[model samples]
Target: MTNKDKSHLCWTIAFSVGLLFSGRAAQATLPIELEVAMEPGSSLTAPQEWTRILGKMNLSRVRLRSIRSTDQPSVTHVQVGKSTRYRVLAILSHRDELILPKKHFRMQDRRKLQTYFEQLPNETQRNASPRGRFDLTEKQFRRLFTELSQPVSFATEGKISSEVLHQLQKKLTLPVVQTPRSSVLLELSLRGELQGLSTGTALAIVLRQHGLMLQPEITRDNSMQLTLATYDSQGDAWPVGWKPEKSIRLIAPQMFEQLTLEATNITFAEVLSQLKPRLKVPIVLDHWILTQREIVPDQISVKLARRKTFLKGALNRLASQARLATEIRIDELGQPFIWVTQFGKDSPRATQ
Candidate 1:
């Protein structure tokens, strides 16, 4: 054969082989689109069923290797390969029957799952449990679902006062207690409609306007209670004038026993202030003692020779000079508080 013919033949073979491989690659990457007539109301009841159905769906490019249903109802363990779209579609197709088991619905992207859950019907959500049903009461579940799933979208003209806000909260079925001290009477000029925003988000916007927030408290009956309160920057929202004895008892010994002193000519009050942030715990001076003595914390110079000393020992040594003693007190919530009182006065002692 002539060199020119042989060259042409080689080029033709190479082109054909290239086309074959390209076709194979395209076919491998293409998604399998199925048009099955799924039974109405038919759903995969368990993780095994989900796995089997996904396998039969010819998702060769994707893998749904395993599904674990035995975990918490809000969590699902799904082992999947690179294709997230198929997995999301499969889960959504059987969303009503599949217990997602995840605290947050997440797919290929974080926001996709959030958007999906936001659009889920209340009935579908109630049924989207691994156990096939929610254990909470209808009212409880409704409250939770509304808070989690519903987006807040409302615009109001004029100023929104605390009273008006309280009324609005009632309209949303959120319970409010009208306490004389608990009234958050800040007026806000709010004007914006939230789109696809959770109830918590809506409440946060309203609360931020008034420098307040919602906090959960345990009632005397051991039931959960939601309260509107002043926003604490430090995130310490203990009851007013309340101490934390239980927490202090549990924490003080560990914190103070290892306390090391290295102050150089700093006032006792300054020392306390420095210790306060370092300890990362709550410590308050006794108001009665401060009022009675009219002593300034910054004025009282504290001289502690650099030494690693236990908190109790350091406090005892400094107490005489500062005219103050330390005590752990309990609050209404059974949490502990550290109180610095007059050294000689009758005061509560730390729990052993």
Candidate 2:
């Protein structure tokens, strides 16, 4: 018998003993009495089927309650004395009926389930997390945000949309899904390059060219995923990018720098093309607004009296006359640009 073997055995014994006692201590976390309210139209099976897993997770005395679908949110209204009770907002799994936040979890994997359950937030801090139509846990969303902020370069390289989609699937960490694969999105061979842009920003631009939008949704238990879907004017979708953290004045000083301007009988499009190089940022038109309003930039004339003003100031007057709005927004990578959109909406056209 070696002294080294004895030492290893002693450490293993200590760890086993510690884990056993810790599990016992964790047993009092919540009252055994809990209710699993099945929201209306939820595909989940009878709540009684959850008994075995709930028992394994130490939630034994769970009751079932059927609910009616309503415009109001489904929040459990239970009182557990002076202590706070967690309001969990969960979606049932379509395949195999396992609850999410339980990654690759099988009913037989009780030890792993117990370990994960034990690591959850303490009773007081376990509040419900919901935002917008699609929601991810706060911790999960933060992780997704951090990953999207990484800078990357992407080029179409004459590949069809389907090929491009496959390429994106390979490059991104999240699973990419394109539903009903549009003939245009699948067949159109796009040509463009987005260099030194955040992954999310680059993807949004690339997808826009195909008339599709990049939507991050909660599907997998471990991570939020990306979906390529047709743009919906009424639906809530992810933004093409975000407003820069830095002030607009600092990020695009060139656009704000004073310049003397005089234009007589020149079309707005001509002026924009001439000023594009000076702005040092891309000037993008909301195609939706232009197409819907039947606005042709070349046909709209601009006549400005000689004055000392910045590019954005002049642009504001021109956009206002055409019933358009100009906003400076940043991409996920913090690159500033001018976004021209329809005037009626208070927010950017790209966002909800």
Candidate 3:
């Protein structure tokens, strides 16, 4: 058995934020606990590879220690008997071993590692958008992903917010938080019927409609819950989908099936409606940007010249004319969907 109180580290960067050695009990809540276990046969002292790992992190808010294993005590790790758990174990393990198996921990990933020490739960938090430090460690999320991916067959369309959450919580065996603070989201009517999507994907899509998300939080005493929240620009919001396991061509061969086509002065909405039946996935618009630009799908006109091309090529030409962009996104379960948004950069893909 392993002690939960202390953190183990394979990284021994020069501690900058007055970092203490791994012996003192935590006096107050610190940043998220990180367990950077040394890979098998790796050295306890700095290695050339792990040293570069330190440079990759934005360590201003993070604390670190040099310890050999989980049993070793360190100030930067969690305390025994403390309710809170380590944000993640095997921090610098390199292999995701999760949905993103091929991924190397990136600089962007550092945001998810910290528990956002300053943004602890507060009653006042409800009045504002649900922005706080992300508490779900990568390992924790991977364990939960498979269940989130499997679809629960039902219509969450007309159900009120609270009841929908209750059913979801019962199914997943995890807390689904909708505190009084975020009451505005409760009792609000769902804009459209949700069918044929997994539990997590369905919930994420609904929340995104209102700029909210189901961010995981590990409360004290090793308890865990997924909270409904709105994140600040910097906070890592969990995503509705993962990268498709199969290549785009393999996943949707119809997208590449060639055909001669010409579209003249057709509204974007008409084009999508005509194409919707041909593809297996739904084509969704970026309503947020559309509202911002006061551009309606039916109002924008697209013109494409006669040419032999794939469905993707034809859509790209139409999307460009409508000031939109397109990409393939898969749900946690590897179900692909087509996303159409204003012509601009894509948001970071959420894979929780």
Most accurate candidate by lDDT: 2
**Which portions of model 2 show Cα errors greater than 4 Å?**
1-133, 152-167, 181-183, 189-193, 209-211, 220-222, 345-352
| Model 1 lDDT tens row, 68-97 | 342233212233485422223233223434
lDDT of 2 by residue, 207-249 (tens): 6656677777764233467777897655445666776667778
Error of 1 at 265 (Å): 1.3
Q: How badly does each model clash, as a count of residue pairs? A: 13, 0, 8
Cα miss at 197, model 2 (Å)?
A: 3.1
For each of the candidates, the C-alpha root-mean-square deviation to the true structure, in angstroms, is 20.9, 14.3, 16.1
lDDT of 2 at 177: 73
Once model 2 is optimally superposed onto the true structure by TM-score, how far is the C-alpha of residue 298 displaced, in angstroms? 3.6
Model 3, residue 209: C-alpha shift (Å): 0.6
lDDT of 3 by residue, 1-352 (tens): 1232222333324243224323322433543444343333333333334334433332223333342455332222334575433343333332321111123444345444232322322211221233334644555666667668767477766677656666666778777777564557656655444567677777776766665667777665445678888734465556656567678999888899888888887898898888888766866555555666677889988888899999998998898888877888777767778877664433454332
Q: After the best TM-score superposition of candidate 3, give how far the Cα of residue 322 lies from its true spot, in angstroms.
A: 2.2
Task: Answer with 1 or 2, whichever has the higher TM-score.
Answer: 2
- In model 3, which runs have C-alpha deviations exceeding 4 angstroms? 1-139, 156-167, 343-346, 349-352
What would you estimate as the lDDT of candidate 3? 0.57
